[model samples]
Target chain A: AQSVTQPDIHITVSEGASLELRCNYSYGATPYLFWYVQSPGQGLQLLLKYFSGDTLVQGIKGFEAEFKRSQSSFNLRKPSVHWSDAAEYFCAVRDNYGGSQGNLIFGKGTKLSVKP
Target chain B: EAGVTQFPSHSVIEKGQTVTLRCDPISGHDNLYWYRRVMGKEIKFLLHFVKESKQDESGMPNNRFLAERTGGTYSTLKVQPAELEDSGVYFCASSRIAGGETQYFGPGTRLLVL
Candidate 1:
């Protein structure tokens, strides 16, 4: 089975400060990874996704993540986070079983708090 | 274009009552999925639909939960004789096709069982 772990339960950052959210996954083979953001009372929105491609994938809202196979990590980073960036972020992985359509396995999620 | 939409954003029902949730996928999306997040738990997959057909329903908890997509466009999930354990936020998502496509999610329907 495949699983994802997000170590941080909550993180607080000041506006214009850089931020990093750690994510680790346990999968037998190369896996498809994704990051999503969910504002309070809103549905999740895709921040970015990584399939077979460059190690560094850039996404919307000036966010990026690096896929490190050696560490089994795909950490999300943003140089300067705005106040609007405060939201709950989830790290997910796609699991393929016997050539069947796979579903996303999401981590518990990290709640981000942006301060002024 | 309008994104995925779910009806009855909030519902509160007593135990043993029935509840139904609806999801409307994107206009051309062919794949629809159902997921739920219980209190203090990660979101779990419940089922997936490819058009009007159920592509995968391995994650369904039990027969009490039923999902249908009659015309391959909109989908519905019904829980009969709901239990206290069934209280959670149910989310609906849709994708254009299968395999590696990004799925868009709806705001979700929050179900409260008292």
Candidate 2:
């Protein structure tokens, strides 16, 4: 079955430190990968997505992700972490089987904590 | 423009009671979806609606859950005789088009059953 895996359950980083959150997916075809973040009381916000073309994808809030097909991974990275960036991050793969309208399969989220 | 919005940000009820969650998608969005996340699990899809029609409900756990999109507008998900296992956060999302569009999500409804 198609699934997304976010290996890290919780990660702590000092403010201004570099950050990386790992994600791996199991899918049969070329997958559409996405990163979403949910702050305390906010909804899930789109960080970045990778469908085709260049492997590096840039998203809002100074976040970027790289799609590595060979490794079946789409890990999110940021050059520097901000206190406001502390949030729960989720990795998801779009199931394109039942058309592009296919439902999204999400991974158990990774919660990030920033320490000043 | 307003993003998706869900009513009753939180709900708490005893087992065997009924609860209904509402979702109002962004104006002009043709597609809406429902997802749920139990305590320690990944958020899973529950269903999808294209306007007023139910396109797919394969992810719905059982018949105890009923979802409807009336007149292609706001939608509601009603759970009758709710069970403890039904306690979770329910999320609603919308997009103008399905295949290649970004889905905007709403603050989820956190449900707790005693």
Q: Between which residue pairs do clashes occur in model 1?
A: none
lDDT of 1 by residue, B11-109 (tens): 999999999999999999999999999988898989999999999998889999999999999999999989999999999999997768998999999
| Poorly placed runs, candidate 1 (over 4 Å) | none
lDDT at residue B93 of model 2 (Cα atoms): 96
Error of 2 at B68 (Å): 0.4
Total clashes in model 1, counting residue pairs 3 or more apart in sequence or in different chains: 0
Which docking category, incorrect, acceptable, medium or high, applies to candidate 1? Answer: medium
lDDT by residue (A1-116, candidate 2, tens digit) is: 78899999999999999999999999888898889999999899999999899999999999999999899999999999999999999999988775437579999999999999
In order, candidate lDDTs are 0.94, 0.94
